[model samples]
Target: MLYFIGLGLGDAKDITVKGLEIVKQCSRVYLEAYTSILTVGKDALEDYYGRELILADRDMVEQEADEILKGADVSDVAFLVVGDPFGATTHSDLVLRAVNAGIQYRVIHNASIMNAVGCCGLQLYNFGETVSIVFWTDTWRPESFYDKIKKNRDLGMHTLCLLDIKVKEQSMENLMRGRKIYEPPRFMTVSQAAEQLLEIVQNRRERGDDLAISEETICVGLARVGAEDQVILAGTLRQLASCDLGGPLHSMIVTGHLHPLEVDMLQIGCPGRNPCIKYSYQDG
Candidate 1:
């Protein structure tokens, strides 16, 4: 049997009881480290689980998956994922391969940021389509996610932006030279994502695209959610453009037309009880 386990957002103890049991029972355990990461490191997890984990980088999971899946017919194998197993499409594909190979599998689930994000006091049902904001590379800026946010905001629904994370990535120069070098892992913070969004809005507005979102729109910046020191702030896009949300693994929520309950909830969520003040374009 193959087990796909979700190690929840915070730490090693965050693993579900069932997942921990499976981890101990499995013959081989591979920790998938790329898509997203837990608050703690591998050694911490190993110390708790009492198992030496094999670190599966992008190359191992994407290219050499068969090796991980090998011997599954004879022994139980467990693949650990940072969030929910289905959070990344790659794990879904892994399950497909296991099924095709006639390997029985079970998913042990845990809390992912997708749902835990509601701890920010926003209504989960009020959130619309989730969009991923990626790192803007030189000469390769993409603004397509802006349209999704606009659509969500148009319908009076919130937008959850899952920031990008680059792990075990290789530079083009190194790749072309056939070198075995990789760049340090990077996780996009809420501030960086907001800066990129504001830039896109500014570019579109300069191009006379009146449909672009303005800088005064409300945005919520979150950092290290589900951790002990998680920080959440509600402010305008302009205000958040310069805020320092320390560390990686950040996410942002573009708010919608506010309900009284949501306003009350957010008032409690933000520090100093400052509820988001309403600002609409039509008022002018």
Candidate 2:
């Protein structure tokens, strides 16, 4: 049997009791490392779960999936993910492959960013389509996510901006040279995402495009969510672009319509920031 387990957002102890039992009993356990990560390392998880873990990088999970599912037909194999296994579409493809191989599989779901993001006080139902912000290069700067944010803003729906995480990524030069060298892993900061967003807003202003998001738009910055030391900061987009929330694994929310209660809750997170929160409706 193939078991796809969610490790939750925080630490090793965050694993569900049922999931922990399965991990303890499983013969081989693989941790999906590229998509997301936990506050603790593999050693910490192994020590807590009382099992050895094999790190399944992007290449191993995508290119060498057969090896992962090779002996699953007979014995139990566990695939661990930082958040819900289905949070990333790639894991769904793995399930499809398992189905085609006639292998039995089970999914143990847990809290993922898709839902845990509500901890910031934004109603989950209020959020529209979630978008990912990737790292921009000198030659390549994509603003595809801006349109989605605008669409959400137009509908008075919240926008969850998932920051980019580059793990075990290789540079084009290394790839072209057929080298195994990997670039340093990078986790996008809230500041970085805001800078890109502000740049897009500038371009829109220059081109006379419809403006829903602006410097004063209410935004929330989250860091190391689900951890004990997790940080949540609420401010304007411009303030967030300059504020330092500290640590990795950050997420930002571009708010649209704000309920009275939401405004109060988010205001509490703003501390001393002025004009704490402003939504799209305020532009009117």
Candidate 3:
């Protein structure tokens, strides 16, 4: 049997009881490392689970999935993922591959950022759509996500901006030269996301497009979510751009029409008391 298990957003101990038991029972355990990461390192997880984990990079999972699935029909194999197994579409593809290989599989669900993001005090139902912000190069900046954010804002719904994470990626030059060299892992921070967002806003202003967001727009920045040292700050886009949110695995929420209760909850994460007061409809 092939088991795809989700390790919740924290340390190794965050795994559900059933998931942990299955992990212990599996003969081979592979940890999917590219999509998202847990707060603790591989060693910490190994220590807690009493089993060593094979780190599966993007190449191994995408290019050599068969090797991981090999013999799964005869033996138990476990593929562990940070957050829920379905959080990323890649895992779903793996399940499809498993089915074609005549392997039986089971998915164990866990908390993913998609739902845990509500800890920031935004109503889940008020969110329209979630968009990913990728790392932009000098010649390859994309602003399509800006339009999605605008659509959500126009409908009076919040937008959840998932920051990008680049792991085991090859440089363009290296790829062209046929070199297997890998670049260092990078996790986009809330500050970086804000800078790119503001750049898009500036470009739209230059083009005389009706701006959906502005420098004064309210945004909530969350870092190291589900970890003990997690930080959530509510402020304007300008304030967030200058604020230091500390470590990685950050996410940002672009709020639309705020409810009074939401304003009250998010105010706790603000720099000062009643910081969200400026965003209150009553103020306008």
Where in model 2 is the C-alpha error above 4 Å? 270-284
Kindly give the stretch of ten consecutive residues in candidate 1 with the minimal lDDT sum: 275-284
Q: What tens-digit string does per-residue lDDT give for candidate 1 at 200-279?
A: 99888888986636788878888877777677877788777777778768999989877778766666674432234333
Q: Write the per-residue lDDT of candidate 2 for residues 222-274, one digit (tens) a residue.
A: 88888877878887788789977677889999998898888777766532333
Candidate that beats the other on TM-score, 1 or 2, i.e. the better one:
2
Worst 10 residues of 2 by lDDT: 271-280
lDDT score for candidate 2 against the true structure: 0.89
**Per-model root-mean-square deviation over C-alphas:** 2.6, 2.6, 2.5
Q: How high a TM-score does candidate 2 get?
A: 0.95
Model 3 misses residue 19 by how many Å? 0.5
